[model samples]
Target: MTNPAIEAFVQEANDILETLEDQLLELEGSSDPAQVDAVFRALHTIKGSGSMFGFTRLSQFTHHFETAFDLIREGKLAIDGKLIDLSLKARDTMRRFVDLGGDNAEADQLSEAAEVKNLVAALQSLTNVTSAPETTEEGASQAGAASEIAVFDIWFKPAADDLRNGLRPDLLLGELEDLGDVTHRLDLTAVPSLEKLEPLQCYAAWAVTLTGATTEEAIKDVFIFADDSELEITKHEPPVAASEPELTTKTVAADKGKSNKTTAPIRVDSGRLDEVMDRLGELVIAQARLNQVTTRLADPMLEAVTEDIERLLTGLRDTTLSIRMMPIETVFGKFRRVVRDLSAELNKDIKLVTKGGETEIDKNVIDKLSEPLVHMIRNAIDHGVETREGRIEANKPEHGTVILSANQEGGEVLISLEDDGRGLNTEAIRARAIERGLLDANATPTEQELHQFIFAPGFSTAKELTSISGRGVGMDAVKTTVDSLRGNFKVHSQPGQGTKVTLHLPVSLAIIDGMLVRLGSDVFVIPLSAVQECVELDTLETNRESGRSMLRIRETLVPFLDLVDVFNYPESKDTRRRVVIVRAGNAPLGLIVDDILGQNQTVIKALSVYHRDVEGFAGATILGDGTVALIIDTAIMIRRALQQAKAQEAPSKYVAAGGH
Candidate 1:
């Protein structure tokens, strides 16, 4: 079995490193003491805890870095560009050590590598101070005169089952020995007789007394990961002249009302959460079946029980989904380094400003967002943001700004990345589209339509290739990912101002509230988030005379698509057909269906390989009658209608010109 404590360290180290990057990037602009102190504390925790957990190499490597920050904390050193750059590099090295799981063959080799050696040397040069050697029993006695010595009384007893969970008290004791002059005695009062002994159980405990210039906090950290054990630390203050000895005793419990972890969150593996969601999806399907049975039986008691179950399931679903939801800031926090590095590499001054980071989305969606957002950021810098001199000439600030913002709108999350720089070159995009045979030469497409050509496969208007863009694959991949998530994107640009790309994505991909509609023999689900309103269709006003299918809701003439024609089904003979108006981008389109079924919770499942490539259907879900209903992708269906309309208009326009 994997060691839970080590796994916890890995997770924590990842978070610390991410925050470290953001902190270091901020340090470049401001030298706030609190920020510096925060950085120092983080490094000290990693170093101290790293040592206690068998990461000797990582601990040793981080000592030099910790020393540098210690000097900066003491006003012995100052922050500069060189220090920041090297510190960032050192932080990267620390991440590598953590990723390698510390104190292994790879980590051993990394410690001896030239880059690490050089990084350590550069950090050492910052303060010209080498780390004090590890405190030894004899060394502690000699150093006692130099600093006020602290005496600690430590006692710990591992839980009887801790050994089975991979807790090694010996390692914890050895780590404490490195802190100061340590002496200990074993307590075996709990040890059972040979006849009753359990081989894997821990019965012995330790009482250790240490004299060192270290706080009780440092000693407690030796057993930090052993949260299930019992631990106590007492400090003995030195006696004043002619005074009796005094002591301040603090009882620090490991698992029982532990001082440190009272408010700490319980970290769970996301894979387990996904598994719960899958089981919940099945429960939803079974609930649908139950609802169907109760409806047929028409029994009052069964109906009452069914209603209670429905109410409880709704609560369970909302609770489970909220557990999976995380703030978008988790992804947004990563790009500070990206922008900083890109600015330095491109010799441009660009600042990244983010807003609405508190908006939350499902974990699964956020996991896939980082890469596409990175690509978008890269393009914003490489193609959108102008050079410093160019900005000066354009009467703009020397520094370019890229703003990434996200917000929840109804049932969808809108994430937008916008930059202030010379915007899209429409003429260049249009020219490239025609050259690539993606657009007709004689066609007059809107600027918006022309701008979308950037996402076309193997499409670029760049004069030359750079390592970043001109490969023509980044935006295409982004569009593919967005579409796979059942989302759509829009691009808006002003020639002299900037370009903004906005992605509209569903808040949760696993389950959603949906409106059901029937098309011939098929029942289809439309995401309730996109559905505006439903109306009874009046077949008498077909508007076939105008050579178009349209509906006038109030006064607006909204185009409508007949499912009988769109899906090639037999014409619906029902005179009471309904039109479901759904929002698509900025326009509203009407979908004509044979009947309007009520709404229900939908569990979305990915399509099988055979139907995966097919358009218009997002996925399939089980209905109350145990039948499969195809979920309509509203945005895609509307876009398809627009494409078909455009295709028809092309033939009519050519015929109007009297073309044979």
Candidate 2:
């Protein structure tokens, strides 16, 4: 039989060991006594947990690592970077040993073990020989000395979430057989009635009595499955035999589990959740068809049933979407390792700070966002922040700050990567753009337009491409990845201040609340959150004297993008037009449309591989009537407008000054 308690212990141990190893590698250049102490605690936790789980091999191996580090802590061994590297390698070997089930047969495991033994030998040469085991309070406690035993009792209280993690109280009681003739007692005062039962909640506690060879450590291991449980272990001087009629351990244990087996939490896989979403989508479509039929029949009962089904479908969809949400921090947390390694390699003093990490995004989107975030951080350190000496000369702090934050705004998650460093160099960027043949020789672009040139392929302003950055790889990759996700990316900068890159992504790409609209021959879906208001466009009166058209909304002159001109659609040949006002970043634009089709809950489907690169089309969604409408990529459209705005602004500046 597989022991879940031991397996959980092994998994926890392995994860902690990996973190320790990564931290040790990060601590190579640091001489802080506090960090060394932290490293010792990590190894100590692994060793203690390993022995508890019966992984004797791992415990033995980690003991040596712990001893060597203890020597360093005590000043017996000198601190050095090479030693830290060796310790990190040994940590990796011990992880391999734990993974190998502590068996010594696999060639790779044997090789790693041999390497660890050699490293241990090298470390041992720096220490004085100890003929006998070192005596510490912990060692004395484990020795079962006659003076150490105390007479008391233990109360193990499991939390409600403990059972949801696959722990069973009765099964844990069964494992207590090793500590002598043990009697298990359980408390079950919180069990609710069947009607109010929640399967995931734990409703009991345990009391165990054991004799002979039993230590507090031994007793605690029996409840390994209940790690989050509140364990009160009062040491008893001698193992006491069960005697009281009211305290018969078997009777208490049996009674506790007897009344309640009715509910257990159901575990559903991700594939099943996706299946539920698909069924909900079909029901939504079917409900639309039913409403259409009922309109012709004018049946009252059919209308009521349709209303009920709509409510249920809406609930089912919400439940399914909630299941797919995971905190963005999971991906964001790994950047500590990246920042640590990059800072060490570059010899730069940089601190990473993250906020609003609890904000959730679609699981798929969070998974893909990691690479782009890493690239941006790397770019900030390599090219954005100045060198330590140079930064001081520039009257800035030596340690640069990079902040990654995410928060939900209405229906989309706004993630911003900002750095307090030198902003983009417009003169250098403009010159590079000309060198790359991306701009005219005599052209002068505004700061905002100049910043956009970095996203173009093979654009680098770095004097030479170092390992850290400047190879023209990461920025374009960020653009492509964000574009693929139907998200928008923007850059804002001010000289001598800082740069901020913002990414606006839908909460979940699979589904959204959308507003459907039509423009000439094509239909478009605007994410409902971005829609401010819709109004009629009487171009004849709204036209500028220079032939430009703008809509005045709330005393703001918002430029209107004629979808017909942008998409090359066949003109409606109508005198009047409808405009949908959408906001991206700080700018709002009026998108010309033929008609406002109604609100919809849309399930977005990605375009075919060939159409993936198509501009302005975020994704495709099927309408209630089965027509395919393209979801609008608002960010790309905004960028295109910005480019056009810049183009229209040029030449007129020189003419205004009478220099043309």
Candidate 3:
């Protein structure tokens, strides 16, 4: 049987392990006392709770892990690279134990594994603390020094069904005893008379006086996993002299003051957030329909009501999106560990500098972004960064630097990974491209064009495959993921300077502000963020014999694409043909359409598998008039048009050269 309590414990333990990693990594950069305490407390919590929830192996393993940090807390050990590395490995072992979900056979095997033995021995060696038998009660009391002992009055009352649900009060009390000298009394006043008592009901409570050099936080950690229980802890000052045994209550105002400052946030499943967003998208589509109907009615009160609805919906949408928005720091924090590990393994001195971590992105985007970012970071370390010796010869610092930054740019979020190393070798990339038949040997391509070849499947400059990379799948996967998010990326490099790749993604995928346009009885939606302005396609200017489809907007010549020809739609005879000027990167493109249909709040629906392969259309959405319209991927269309233009110019240039 799957015990719900055990399941919850596993989930919480995993979360703690993640946090433990971050704390350990942070501790490496600075020997912050608070960070050290946090790490110790996390390990202690895992050990205490793991035993109660049947994670015997995990609990036993963490006990040893906690002892190392305990020594650090007591000034018996110092933070160093060796200790941090062992802690990381020990943390991973604990994670594996938790992953076993208390399967005794597997847990036993893992507990006896050589790796676990090595990790424990390594951890013990650091503290010079032998593996000795000790009870939880003894451990808790010995956790803090008697010289600095503080007394705490702790009252705990478990829920009526807590015992049935696997609450181990005995183990909890033992853990408390482990913290210090303890005087605990069971309050049985609520227990029913034996004749009328229900055997399964919990009718007891506890009041305990604990004197130790432990903080209130330590006491709370004892009850961390028992959310259903009522716990109150008050700290009292230690006796001034051994002869004067009587102690007075010390308010410890600072700790008490922090309790009332903020409300606790509830843990919510991300699946529920996704459901809310899906429903919100549907509500938006319905509101668009109502707005369209109200426009036709032209009644003053109805129009006012429609306007109010729109405003309310807009506010609700913003609020919902904000709820799903998480600071990008959550993702950025993990990379510190990655960089540290990679630097050690690769034997290179590389520093990771992050900025703008407070920038927010939708949770969904953040979840999918981690893997791609990991690949890019690895690529930067393994390929882009030069060896320390190479760096010295290049007149650079011995250590290479990788900068990971995030910020909001208009309606999109821009995340960039830049490395100050030997930038991409354009000549080498060009040669590889020609050898791979990705480019013509005789053709001259721009640096950017040559860089694009790196994203092709199975494209790599590595002479041999290493465990880190060289399979040539990392960059290709990055491109695929960014494209799936309806985002685009750009690469820039200066040969001996560095390389920077920036990704541009929408703030939200559920709803978008789109411009509606029509072409030969079909309606389409263009992302409004990309659209600059709409202008009439002058026939006289377009008919010139230059054999180029270009539009002169003001003084700049921008490439233009006819939607009818691009999509193979029947030609429209509408003389009122208009062109929508949209910017893609630094270049602008004009899209020719039949007519303008104003703006819309489009609830974007992802394309079905059947139509997903279609090049230009990003997705489909139902219009207010009950018609389905395809959403144009402005970035894709602009790229396609530019490619076509380049192809056309290529042939003409070749012919001119042949004539010469």
Candidate 4:
């Protein structure tokens, strides 16, 4: 294997290690036979492949660790807390050995060797317990019984260069003979004419049949050193009532057994896929350039071909990109470990139920979302799930429930975190708002109004300082992080049922479908998710609302925000107005614009630091016409509109009370 292959092996080995660790951790608190088998298989695979890749130190360490797990697998050792703890420690040590290359360095080797020996001794003692009556006497008897089972039949025809490369066909056959009793037959057919055959060339085919007490994997171990040379092995199921003569096949011998599925198809790495996508992107841009260059040719046939090329390239690009798309389940699986550890640490009984984990999203988006997800999970365990006694008083289940789910809707993906515990305390939240001076003492805030305070900077409701919560930060940072990825965040809570936080993120942050609109002298782009509809605004006369136009859509009055006032745009003579209905969470507002330009496929670029603080603008994008357009942060704008609407309604409250 080359360096890249080695790195790939390391990555796969690390994933298996993580799997083993998590299984052991769960087994520490409970006894599960399935978990034991899973842990053993993971360690065994690592040991086998580690040796194949020349990581001798890793192979030796994992081999010893696998024996301990094997004892548990065979019912000789019952797993306990002490065994699980030592297994986790040993797994970590194997990781270190893999990361730090060789065993020749004395200082590191001495330390690791001591830990390995101690863990091995502990494991051996666990297996040495006196025989329990539950164990059947026949189990050990079955281990010694020998039964010959027919394995695979192989057909081999080596190339002329096989002998020159020092690969002897007879040597492979001899290894098979050691595995079990074998019958071999040589065929001279296709050997070619003797006058044309070279002395250094090999041209012979052979068939062999073998029977053994071991598995087919034991047979493949013999020929691991050979590349895909002319060799084929087919496993034969033993006959029940009828008997027939089978063909001769050959098998090789090795330390470990060979697997029947050794020649499985290989998959490309994401880095290679990314490289392909990059080239495809360039192809798309070049095709766009070609369309531009050919427009002046005045040939309909050229235009037709260009259109065909465009369609082909678009299809190719989408196909290539879809290869890198994976289900969100790959990421959600890791959180099981996080929740288990946090539950134990906080002394909280928690169960995590996940749904819609198979929802597909861009791989890049998944990677960037991991850290924010970790934070959300930690917060759910620390603050969202109430303590055991607290739950009983509230007439809820003593064990709290936290749910993580992902679903794809339209062009965006929605990830939600929900818990069944005591909900956010709005009274305490409002008091904190006043104490922090975010609101005045005289200010009366609604329930929805109070919940928004949790997203304010340096705002949290926890009273006492603990390692988990009460650090004076929470939703605000989560909001900021999601916003950075061009995503939207919303929080919902009932008085006692707990809280639900939803994240709406684009499938790919690099590109999106946006609607172009003109605001004053500047052109802006709004994501499609925010746009409900576009309509002509009519003036409202019943309320005698001045300067503001309201549209009645679906039997509800939607207020309009004038872009001229918000953006401070220069004067324009076109009085004809258009309303772009936008939504954020449950709130919707109409954005009044001078013109609604059409749909655009936008590639987003970041705004400079000086312009990042500009409210209501998330990022900027360049159009095909070489014009720069700003993308609106519709969530912030909708929140602002809600507050503005509330303030506008305050006058009616006083009027109803006769203005005392």
- Model 2: weakest 10-residue lDDT segment is 651-660
Candidate 3's displacement at residue 462, Å, is 1.6
Q: What TM-score, over all chains together, does every model reach?
A: 0.88, 0.71, 0.88, 0.75
Candidate 2 regions with alpha-carbon error over 4 angstroms: 1-215, 218-272, 520-522, 539-559, 565-568, 610-614, 641-660
Task: In model 3, state the lDDT of residue 236.
Answer: 67
How would you encode candidate 3's per-residue C-alpha lDDT over 261-314 as one tens digit per residue? 476565678899988988998888888889889988889999999899989999
Estimate the lDDT of model 2. 0.71
The lDDT of model 3 is 0.83
Score each candidate by Cα lDDT. Answer: 0.83, 0.71, 0.83, 0.71
- Candidate 1 per-residue C-alpha lDDT over 1-660 given as tens digits, one digit per residue, 9 for 90 to 100: 667777777787778888998999889988787998788878876776687666788888888888888677555577888989998999999999998986889999999999999999888877684565455466466445435677788888888887775566777777788778999999999988999999988998999998887766567656656766787777776644456554554444543565556666788889999999999999999999999899999999999999999999989999999999999999998999999999999999999999999999999999999999999999999999999999999999999999999999988999999999899999998788777767677877667777777877777888999887887888887887887788888899997699999999999999999998888778899999989998889743555323556687786778889888988998888878899999856657899999988898999988999998888899999987889999998877777766655556543321111000
- List model 2 lDDT by residue over 1-660, tens digit each: 866656666677766775776567556666566777677777766665565555657766776787777665544465676677568667777777778764356624564566666876765664554543455575445454532433336677777776655555655555566446666677777788999988768888777665555555456545543556777665544445466222211112334445564653344556786677777766776776776788888889988887898888788778778888889887777786677667778888888889998998888788799898898999988877777886898899998888999999888899998988898888898788777777776666556556777777667898987887778878877877887776766789878778999988888877788898888666789888778888877742355523446677666778778888888888778677788888776667788888888898888777899997787877888777677889987766766765565456644321110000
lDDT at 355 for candidate 3? 96
Residues 1-660 of candidate 4: C-alpha lDDT, one tens digit per residue: 346546656777877876776677678777687887677767766665565555667777776677776666556677766776677678878778677643457424744676677876776666565663244566455433323475667777665565664455676786578668799899778777879888887777888888776445445545544544566677665663357555444443321225534855456777887777666655655675677667878689989999999899878867766777788887887787788778889989898888998898888888777777887888878877889998999899899999999998888899999998777888888778778767666666567667767667778888788877777555666766777666776778887898898988878765568899987667899998779998865543213143234566767877667777778777655677778888766667888788898886666677898988888887887665566889987876775665555456533220110000
Query: Would you list the clashing residue pairs of candidate 3?
Result: 137-178, 140-178, 140-179, 141-178, 141-179, 141-180
